[model samples]
Target: MNIWTFDQEKDLNTTGAGLIAALLQSKPKAVLGLATGSSPVGIYNELIDMYRRGLVSFANASSFNLDEYVGLPVDHSESYRSFMNEKLFKHVDIKLENTHVPDGNAPDPDAECAHYEQLVNDHGPVDIQLLGIGHNGHIGFNEPGANLTGGTHVVDLKEETLKANARFFPSFDDVPKQAMTMGVASILKAKQILLVARGEDKAEIIRTALRGPITTECPASLLQCHPNVIVLLDRGAGRFM
Candidate 1:
């Protein structure tokens, strides 16, 4: 694993953007596994700038998102599908057909999870995966010690995750208790992983996941086993590390 710490969020975003640009230059049809939440907002913004400048094009690229809240409608303002469309897909040339996010409202939720994994298997081992560490070291809603399913599946959100994510909704009651997420094994199977974090709130978990022992106690610790992971952090998030 490689680590890069920047003085501010802008610098962090720039560094990540440059990395993605280089990857695109080398592999135009890269399979990109994406994540949402505030940590990746800057990266998406930088990608938009690259698209405008002709430094990169996502025309041939395929993308898969990390997770989605299970009960939310696709059009829900807070849904991951809506978040990605607004933040990244709408700004780039990525074909909507090439982009995949778990269907939160699938009537056959179990079938949806299996099919999502099958889709990734057919189109992946992802060329690059963008990830964000939850305040408690959860990754893709796979909270600590949930048996570590090796494929995409539904997850019961931990109380800590619900509390943390409640900020995005109108009230704590608006937060969903369940989510569908790519599993740890699925994520680790990616060819490369770029883990991003910002803010003081993420400092401790970032420290634990990157510098502490690898354990299922912190799902992000699974990244420690991956050979090609780059952990990018703003000073605020990396302080403890």
Candidate 2:
């Protein structure tokens, strides 16, 4: 594990984007495991700037998103698909056909989960998997629990997750209660992992997940087992470190 703390937001974003850009430069066909939410927005913006400046290109890269809210339309404003399109995909030269996000509205969600997991297996060993730690230390919606799933699966959103996401919707009831997410096993399959976090609110959990014991209770803690994990933390999130 290589952990880095940044005193400036731009430094953190550029460093994160630079890592991805370096990977793409070495392997144009690299498979990317992407994440949504506030933590990665700055990195995405930096990547977009790099793309515009001819410093990087995602033309031949393929991507798989970490998770999607169940029951939301793919075109929904709050959907992960829309988030990616707006944040990074449409801004870069990556082909839309090569990008994948689990179908949250699939009629048979179980089948969708199986199919999505297979798709990832067929296309990956993702070169680098990007992640954002949730307040409860959840990763890709794999909430705190006694046991964690091993492949793509549907999950009941924890109350904390629901509350955290409620701010995005018009009302608390408007947030989706379920989601489809990659499992710990699936995420661990990535060749490398880049976990990013920001803000003072994330400091305690960041310390716990990174410095504490490896346990299923804090899903992100499992990243400690991976051989090539890089953590990028803004000063606020790295306070305890």
Top TM-score model: 2
lDDT of 1: 0.91
> Cα deviation of 32 in candidate 2 (Å)?
0.3
lDDT of 1 by residue, 3-89 (tens): 988997888998888888788889999999999999899989998998999889999999999999998989999999999999999
- Predicted candidate 2 versus true structure: per-residue lDDT over 114-157, tens digit per residue: 99999999999999999999999999999999999999999999
Q: Which residue pairs come into collision in candidate 2?
A: none
Q: Pick the candidate with the highest lDDT.
A: 2
The 10 consecutive residues of candidate 2 with the worst lDDT sum are 50-59
Judged by whole-model lDDT over C-alpha atoms, candidate 2 comes out at: 0.96
Each model's TM-score?
A: 0.98, 0.99
> Could you tell me how far off, in angstroms, the CA of residue 230 lies in candidate 1 after the best superposition?
0.3
